[model samples]
Target chain A: MIVAIASGKGGTGKTTIATALARIWDGPRVAVDMDVEAPNLHLFLAPSYDGRKRAVLDVPVVLHPEACSGCGACSRLCAFKAIIALGDYPVVFPEMCHGCGGCLEVCRRGVLGAGKRELGEIFWGRAGAADGASPDLRIAGGQLRIGEAMSVPLIRQVRTKANEMLAEHPGDVIIDAPPGTSCPALSAVREVDVLLLVAEPTPFGLHDLGLAVRALASGRVPTGVVVNRAGLGDDCIRAFCHKHDLPILAEIPFRRDIAEACAQGIPLDHMGELRTMMETLARSLRELAEPRVAA
Target chain B: MSLIAVSAQGDTPEASVDPRFGRAKGFGLYDPSAQYWSYLSNDAAQAQAQGAGLAAVELLARAKVTVVLSGSIGPKAAVALRAAGIASVEGADGQTVRQAVAAHLEMPQRGDAKS
Candidate 1:
């Protein structure tokens, strides 16, 4: 089953829950970090490098300065403003380029050339348990190149590459999506069988949670919430869920030990209470994927 | 021989020059030799969220306008206009399109005045 761990607010325990669940699956499983901008799952899983590859996008380039004809057509057609006609030729801004290739289509003088830009890299490795022995679980994720403003393209490539890897190995797929309601986050969550939402019990968390709920609900994706750091704040989150008819499948209480372990890249599954919560979350997600699995 | 295009706020040549070049609401095209003038919208720029200057250059160039008078022109659009053999003159913002056009005509004749 494909599951995505997401949150509207950052630092709400998406990575913690995702890594823990992947470790506990026992069966063949893959954990994909879809947060290309600041991918941190690598620190938690500490996978030994197995494979790496670059991802690229087809961007347009200005060519044949003599053939430009000073028409400014390419610049006019570029919706992204990546190209500008400056005295006889269009100047190209690689950073602003969305690679739409619209300039090439609009240029009658054939001065626009097809080009590619490296978006980022995808890396995969086998990770061992806390004991450092059985490296049964494999972790893979995307990393966007520094100074690259676009994350959606990298996220798309990461998801595709991870899917291919998982298909070759065949296992439960869980994605730790980037924090937000933006396109990058949406791209990561798309097509997943279950969306595991991690939310804190604070007011900011509550506000962003509502946004997440609305965003996922509009797409009609099945979702459940895991209230991270529960009991630290008021029960407003629970009350909100109850009113919205959204299920609160698990609650990871605010604990000093869990927080400390997480800081050092340790999984919380070894803890009894947290393990039960993770199991409950897994079971709930399984039920959604296959109706035969009971609560 | 000079055809001037002023980024404009209205249809009449008397309309004030629109300060923005790439996303001007409309452009007033004027011919010095024929004493003819008209207005055309910068459609390409208006259609999208970005690259307004890039898009606006196309219509200006296509109309065969040799000179552009406006409050401002972006670097990208400026490059396009220059490559197309168009000259840009600034600081006619808030001036009527007709006045901006007339002002441009007088600058060259005076020769010593800064454009």
Candidate 2:
């Protein structure tokens, strides 16, 4: 089962919760980070990737300018303006192309050819426990190249890699999804068995959580909430979750030392209190995921 | 005699030039041969979530305008305009539509616009 950890508002502890879960997960599991735009899971997990592969998308390339009729059909066909017909040829903006291949299909003259544009890179490796006592956990993630506008495609690739890893590991896949309710976030949680929302208790957090809850309402995935920095803000988030019928899986109290430890690249599973909390959280997640596993 | 399109606040040539090429209110289409001026609303382009400038370029291209007089054109729109073979002159924000066109006519001709 794939369990995605997401949040509508950024900096609300999605990564913290995901890493915590990965560090203490009971069985064979893989932690996949889907925040390609600004991935930080690697910094916290310190996973020494064995190898990395480029993430590329198929884009249209103008093969023969001489054969072009300059009918502007390709330009009109491209909604992203990735292709535009110049005087007698079509100029392609590969960065803007969505890889739909509509231009290639529309071109009756066979002037367009398939080309690859590198969107990002994906890395796979294993992250071992800091104490070296427990078995190492498999980890995989992606990073979008600088100046690349799209993240959804790269996120999909990371999810695919996670699925492949699960075939070997035979355990829950913990995904640290990108923040917000946009395409990137939705792409990460698309086919997950459960989504664990990490939210704060502030008003802004509550508001954005509501937006996320509303956005994912259609997916009908079994969702639960984990309130981070729980004591700082009001009870609104809890109230909101209660009204939405989302179970409160756990809450990490607002503590400066915990923040400092995280900043120092210390996983929550290493801390005495947080380790117990992560263990308990893992049990709860396993229970939540059991229904799907049995099916 | 090719058509010249000027991004304008209003439909008339007397209206002030719209600084934005993509989100311009409308275009004042000037027919040099007929010495006539007409209007084309750019509402469709202005409403685009993205590629507004490219949409505006398409508008001018469909109108068969050889020259476009506007203030600032975004980099993407600029590329689209050049690809569309539409000559453009920037820094026409404060001038009236007619004056901007007149200024372009006074300048020495070049393959590309004086950006």
Candidate 3:
């Protein structure tokens, strides 16, 4: 089963939950970090993989220095306004360019040419036995280059590579999605069969959680929630769940050790209760995947 | 010269009635006769559902070159136009639709036009 762990806000322990779950379920599993813009899962997994492999997500634009006749036809046809004329020459902003190649097709002079810009890198590694030995669990993630704004395409590339890895070793897949309910998060969520939403008990958390929940519901994916740092906040999250008919799968209390371990690049196993809770969460997740097992 | 349509959004030719907040709304340029931009829209609504923006295919169906005069566009729209053999232009401001079109037509051609 494909399981995606997501949160509305950043720093709510979505990666912690995803890594812990992967560690607990000792089987053929692939942990894919689709937070392309800021992939941090590798900090915990520490798989000794090769150096970065450049991944490019090309955006199309018109190179006016070539065949562009200043006909303005390409500009007139573009819906995104990606093209603009400065004096007599047209300049293409690589960041804003989507690589649509419309300029090449529309140019009466056939001036447009294809060009690519590097967006990010996809890394692969195996978790060390000392960290949390799971021969079956292989970790792969994508890290977007800083200052790059296009995240959905990079996330899509990560998912595609993860899918390719899974095909080779057929097993359960757990995806750590980026925070928020935007296109990047949506891209991660769409590929999963089950979704685990990690939410905090703050007002902001609740608000973002509602957005995430709405996005998941719109996609018709079965979803559950795990309230991280549960002991700090009131019962607003619980009440909201009750009213919305959403399930509260687990509640992780606030712990300094967990925070320290994360800061020190240590896994959740360093904390006793958090590890146990993650194990239980893993079992429940398996049950959710195979409901008939309960019967 | 083939006709292409452009929208205010950067590269997505898809027609959206309501350009989401922070997203630009405008026409997309493409070779209208080639039907290349149609590949951008996964469904009919995305391609032709005219709430606010124009689909890349729809833009291509109308014109050969598109001049984007808006703020931004999503990646899907950009990829669709590239695949359909469309040309894209960006950074168009302070100009009306007619002025943008006129500027594009006056630009120099890079190579011989394809048959």
Candidate 4:
């Protein structure tokens, strides 16, 4: 099953929980970090990245201006208005273009051509035990190119690779999604079977969580909550979750030691409180992931 | 001489230009040769999701304005202005709408605005 760990607020311990779950997973699994703009899962996963592939976007570029009459048809058809007829050739803004390809279709003289730009790269690695044991977990994730306005394309690539691994691995695919309820966050959790909303117990966290839940209401994904740093705020989050009927799968209390270990790049494994919580989650996930028998 | 449109706070030549093009309160359309000015209310700027500058450009273009004096212009608005053969002039900030128009006329014409 595809499990996406997301947060409406950043720094809410998504990576902490996701990496811990990946470490304690008892079966074949692939953990992907979909926060391409600022990926940090490598610090926790400590995966050896042995392979990578560039992700490219096909944008509309102006070519063959000789065949064109400066009719401005393509520019008018563009939703982004990336295409514009200028003195000699129409100026094409590659950055603003979403690569929708309508300009090429609307060009009467075939003056428009397909151009490609690298959005990011997907790095695939293997996470091995600290003691030099054989790696059991496949780690795949991406990082968006600097100055690139879009992260959806890179996040989509990470998900694509994770889904491919799931087909072969027969295990859970946990996606460490980007924060907030924006397009990047939605892109990460779009096709997941289960989405873990990693939230902290604060008014702001709960506020954004409510907004995220409203956004996710339109999509078909089962969701659960994992309260990180659970003691900082009042029981408002608990009340909200209870009122919304969102299952509280786990609550990781505020721990200074865990934070220090994570900050120092130490794999936080077998920690008594967290391990028990992860174990319970793993069992519940196994049940959710199990294929239903034919009636 | 190119007709010009300046984002302005009021209808007269003494009114300072609004730096924000898309959200300007009003615009003053001027004919350089004739030294005449007229006002158009920018009622659409407040409610538009986007492309407010382009909409303002459309209004100016319809009035045969060949240059735009604004506090700022968006990328899409720049493209639209370029396509329509209209020049965008910056540094209009803190200048009156008429000063902005006169400034564009006084300076040596550049190929593009300083973004």
Per TM-score, the best of the predicted structures is 2
Residue-wise C-alpha lDDT for candidate 2, range A1-295, written one tens digit per residue? 7788999999999999898888777777888999999999888778878779999989999898889988889988888878877566887878888888899999999999999989999999988765542565888999999989999888888878877877766777889999999989888888777888988999899988998887764546778889999899899988998888888998899999988998887888777788888888877877777787678
Please compute DockQ, using alpha carbons, for every candidate against the native two-chain complex. 0.35, 0.53, 0.04, 0.28
lDDT of 2 by residue, B1-115 (tens): 5788999999888999999999999999988778888999999988876678888888898888888889899998888888888988889889899999888777777743432
Can you write out model 3's per-residue Cα lDDT over A102-139, one digit (the tens) per residue?
76677676556677878888887667667654567788
lDDT of 2 at B51: 74
Q: Which stretches of candidate 1 lie over 4 Å from their true place?
A: A61-113, A130-135, A291-295, B1-50, B59-115
Score residue A51 of candidate 3 by CA lDDT.
44
Q: Compute the lDDT of residue A5 as modeled in candidate 4.
A: 85
Clashes of each: 9, 0, 106, 0
Could you tell me which residue pairs clash in candidate 2? none
Error of 3 at A128 (Å): 1.8
lDDT of 4 by residue, A1-295 (tens): 6777888888988888888878887767788999999998877777888789999888988779788787778767766545656445676777767777888888878888999978989888888777432247889999899889888877877888877776766666778889888889988877667778888889998998898788753435667888888888888789999999888888888779877777876654556566778878766655543442111
Model 1's C-alpha root-mean-square deviation from the true structure amounts to 5.0
- Give the clash count for model 1: 9
Docking class of 3: incorrect
Per-residue lDDT over A88-187 for candidate 1, one digit per residue giving the tens place of the 0 to 100 score = 6778867678777788888888887888899989998888765532346888898999988899888888878887887788887889999989888888
Residues forming the 10-long window of minimal summed lDDT in candidate 4 chain A:
A286-295
lDDT of each: 0.81, 0.86, 0.66, 0.77
For each candidate, what TM-score against the reference? Answer: 0.76, 0.91, 0.67, 0.85
Error of model 4, residue B76, in angstroms: 7.3
Among these predicted structures, which one has the highest DockQ?
2
